[model samples]
Target: MNKNTTIEEVFQNHERPKKPGALNASATFAWRALLRIRYVPEQLFDVTVFPIIFLLMFTYLFGGAISGSTGEYLDFVLPGILVMTVSMITMYTGLDLNKDIEKGVFDRFRSLPIWRPSVLVGALVVDAVRYLIASTIMITLGYILGFRPEAGFFGVILAVLVLLLFAFSLSWIWTMLGIIVRSEKALMGISMMLLFPLTFLSSVFVNPTTMPNWLQVFVDINPITFVVDAVRGIIHGTDAMSDILMVIYISIGLIVVFGPLTMYFFRNKN
Candidate 1:
């Protein structure tokens, strides 16, 4: 007879470790997502490179045309660019989800006994970190290029918080699309269609007051306009209570609407 401990005896001798709770499972998943960044460093290009390009290009190319000077426009548009850069990056959430689904990892994720929402929630948690990274890069480049916030670092913090809340809420729509969309190409097309009009038609590049009444009406109702105004107010030390409130309301509404939709489809997806 074998004197060495067998697998059966080892199993009998050791109690099973405690099962992970919802928060723990979600955090573990988030860490896994973070580790993915190591092998696919290119995944960070949008969050890293695009913000810098938008700030420099928009400030130099369109600055004189719109705001009469690059310095003034940098002060005016840095907040808007920050919002745009982060907002645009949110689409990648859907793209990545669709990729995982195609690769069949989501099926493995689903089979686990962990909390059902942990997968999506974990991705969103890591995405918040990405948003912060994009904000930091943009702000640092802004400083180098002479953009100054009147409300200073604290105000920058507040503005980024609002932006992150909105961005996280906005990501749910893409998450749903990722689960439902047939192909990544179609998803990218849909994202471009939605994002271009939303970002370009708002107050980011030009003031709505300078446009025709009809265009102004559309701009006034545009949700991006409210976010930009809120950030602008926070950064410039102005009274933007209404815009801030609007952003909060919109973020809550987005989460309430799309959050459940994402989970429903995720549970039912083929």
Candidate 2:
């Protein structure tokens, strides 16, 4: 039986793995991304501690000056701070991608028999989880600090869902940069340069009307201004349908522009 074994006998193996579908492939990659968090627990510090720090520091430091009382400013700034915190941290997506490429991890992933975009798709999923964690931390602390959403819990949920959608679209821009840029540090540098103006110069901290004419123009056109307005409106019970729709439109535009670029560089990457 041993010596007479033919090629047909050897070829008749039953344990060959069927290729995973897109969702299954994506979930597997998502698990891999989560394990990195398990091994390097510091990955969570941004989503957890930074939200607390940003909330407390900005609320206490500028609250009275801006709104005449900490309580009043807390109501206004909490939603703004939530957007700022999550948006700032979205750069980590690019940083992680660049790190993987530099370490040649992407090479091994590309050689595998799996849906290719699942790597980036899985990253987007994990970042959404991180963004939700940051949003929850910030909002919960806001509630303890005398902040209340006049639109109540339903509005809070709606605002968060909108925020998560915008963040998902925004990640594609960073993902494209991550594939195009050569180093993680460079990716971070460019991301901050883009994020600072978009967060600070927008209506996150103050009304765009309070800004100078030229600055107001940028603030008016800034996509984040619409997002912050939409979120703040949801919390305050103001009509924000137009702003919400603008945020959605902007999100669609970003995905249309950057999603393909990210994939193009990823596939053609040297």
Candidate 3:
């Protein structure tokens, strides 16, 4: 090809690169996210510091008032705090994607021959690491503060798995927003606006009985409440199967609705 050759001519002359398998392509993009974190360790501030602040602030500030003692409150509230914090942080995935789009990183990825949705899949996979880190910090701090799960070690593991799965599904909503939203700041604002009400208004810091009757209706139906209830049950060795199933259904529905919507916008985005 000559220097004067048109892009169309060049493309015509060149053979199409073979697209890699979905797993391989996704793994590569997931590595890209991890590597970005590795070099810019400060990118982890939200996961690291947010958990500590929420755990300390909420436990001390509302502990006695909510449950009559810090010790009792910690046992009741730590699981909710863990769920709220981790769910909120998952919004960062969308913000990061929006930033990448603003910087034209996705443009470069588009030129590659790999599967289109692999980019989103890989980023979500890397997000699991962030969720894991946040969950660990929350649990460790709770244990240090005298919060103990009645369900024992295995149940704690199960609870973490449930949180991770739900968080992962919820992230798809933000992923769609990131692709469609105009800016990272807008995405961040929108995500927080939705999350704040959901987390705080649910059973995170207080029992629904304490809330007004009208608000109690929303709290009872809130999916985050189901997640908090599910986590509490798992940690306390109570029956959580119904709440867990509810969360799973919500997750599947979100993925069913938003997953394709995100990919459609992603494919259409210039």
Candidate that scores best on TM-score: 1
Write down the lDDT that model 1 would get: 0.93
The TM-score of predicted model 2 comes to: 0.95
Error of 2 at 110 (Å): 0.6
Q: lDDT per residue, candidate 1, 1-270, as tens digits?
A: 268878888768767667779999999989888998878999999999999899999999999998899999999889989999999999988998999999999999999888999999999999999999999999999999998899999999999999999999999999999999989998999998999899888998777899999988889999999999999999899998899999999999999999999999999998
lDDT: the better of candidates 2 and 3: 2
Candidate 2, 121-173: lDDT as tens digits: 99889999999999999999999998999999999999999999999999999
Against the reference, the lDDT scores of all candidates come to: 0.93, 0.93, 0.92
Residue 107, candidate 1: C-alpha displacement in angstroms: 0.7
Total clashes, candidate 3?
0
Worst 10 residues of 3 by lDDT: 10-19
The candidate with the higher TM-score, 2 or 3, is 2
| lDDT for position 119 in model 2 | 94
In candidate 1, stretches whose alpha carbon ends up further than 4 angstroms from where it belongs are 1-5, 10-17
